[model samples]
Target: MGNANQRTQLSEHIADILGTRDQPACGTSRLAIRKTIACGSMMMLALNPAQVGAVGLGEVELKSRLGQPLDATVPLTLREGESLPKNCVKPAPQNNSLARLSDLRVTAPARIGPGTYSVRISTTNPLHEPMYELSLMVKCPGATLLVRQYVLMLDLPGMPVE
Candidate 1:
């Protein structure tokens, strides 16, 4: 009984944070609140995988400057998916030798505590087009969600890589 009450309170707290409460449309507000609660539940579950169930959250897409160290913090409740990898994020093999990715890995906010995580990588050279593929994963129960982002590495003038 107490656990259920606590869960409800937590859901309400998360709903407030997500701005899903007190809307004009009651039906839509309920649905949005429900989704927010589910996301909050996922965050909690991800934080304590051993005690709860799954250990996955969501996905996000990011863009950065070319020839510079890429550091990005993406929210976990960005999208839903089906699979993930052993590591949260990894660099895919690049076909173009002129543009390459190095030192790719997950950095700070290692755990899924704040519904966000950070990734870092160093890109070298310039591509014909401003695009690079980055692989990301989130672990869930019995499955993992895999997301691929075509990061747009913008080429700015007077940049080191340019």
Candidate 2:
């Protein structure tokens, strides 16, 4: 939502500048400015489509197990057909899913699990910032889902007293 607001503000600012700047003060100019800003906004959004939940306030949380791939869709949004750098893939005791950002479709680690793990993924891509870390919490596959369901149930009608 905040990103939407930011995009709106950016467009408005651009339009305001274009309207007031050295351009001709004519109706045709106004139409062109609006169209330009609109196209720019759309392009920006399209290029960032993979940035769904990637609100990188630093550490992103994930869950995984040994031999299972990590999920990297949170902290990193890669361009189409891009893969993680070699250094991004690490050995156990510090396993991660960031490596899966490429063709794995499963895009995390080739070998991981055992317990909670964390690893930082660095990127030189101008779209994503320099780097960010994923705090991977390891557990039985259904455990997290069960906990989530229990939490949702607790929030149901008259489930508990405040």
Candidate 3:
């Protein structure tokens, strides 16, 4: 019973963060909530299709590497039809769908070493919108690391919609 209450509270908190506290759970907010819960420790931010091309989304950054910390702006441009870089491959399936959602890949900077990293962006206001939360996952021999960051999606001209 306590666990159930916690889940309810969490859902409510997420709804509030999403600015949908007053709406029924059957709407888009519901889908967002379900997606959040499904991701398990993953959170999402939802942008209206019309708002996709707006200015001021902010620059997203990856602030960690392997377990070390560093600041790097993540490039949000979608990479199409390219294979994963050597030493970085699809992560094993987990109960959470984070792996599946991490379809965006970008080349890692020298500071992060060789190999590309997989990134997943979700709508979240754990801080604020436009300024969002991002998850960076690095998979390598014998170890996997996940890092979270609150960043602004870059305001780029003609940015593609995810």
Ordering by lDDT: 1, 3, 2
Quantify how close model 2 is to the true structure by its C-alpha RMSD in Å: 20.1
lDDT of 3 at 157: 32
Question: Residues 1-162, candidate 3, lDDT per residue (tens digit)?
Answer: 999999999999987666567766567676666656866544333321121121111245444322222234543221232223343322233343222223333343222322223333332112212232344444533333433334333333354545
Worst-scoring 10-residue span by lDDT in model 1 = 77-86
Estimate the lDDT of model 2.
0.35
Overall local distance difference test of candidate 1: 0.50
* CA lDDT, every model vs. true structure: 0.50, 0.35, 0.39
Ranking by TM-score: 1, 3, 2
Q: Who wins the TM-score comparison? A: 1
Across 24-101, the per-residue lDDT of candidate 2 in tens digits comes to 568648677787898799998777543122111123343332233333322333233433332332212323333223
What is the clash count for each candidate, in the order shown?
A: 5, 6, 6
Q: After superposition, how far is residue 49 of candidate 2 from its true place, in Å?
A: 1.0
Where does candidate 3 stray beyond 4 Å? 1-103, 111-129, 153-162
Q: Model 3, poorest ten-residue lDDT window?
A: 48-57
Model 1: number of backbone collisions: 5
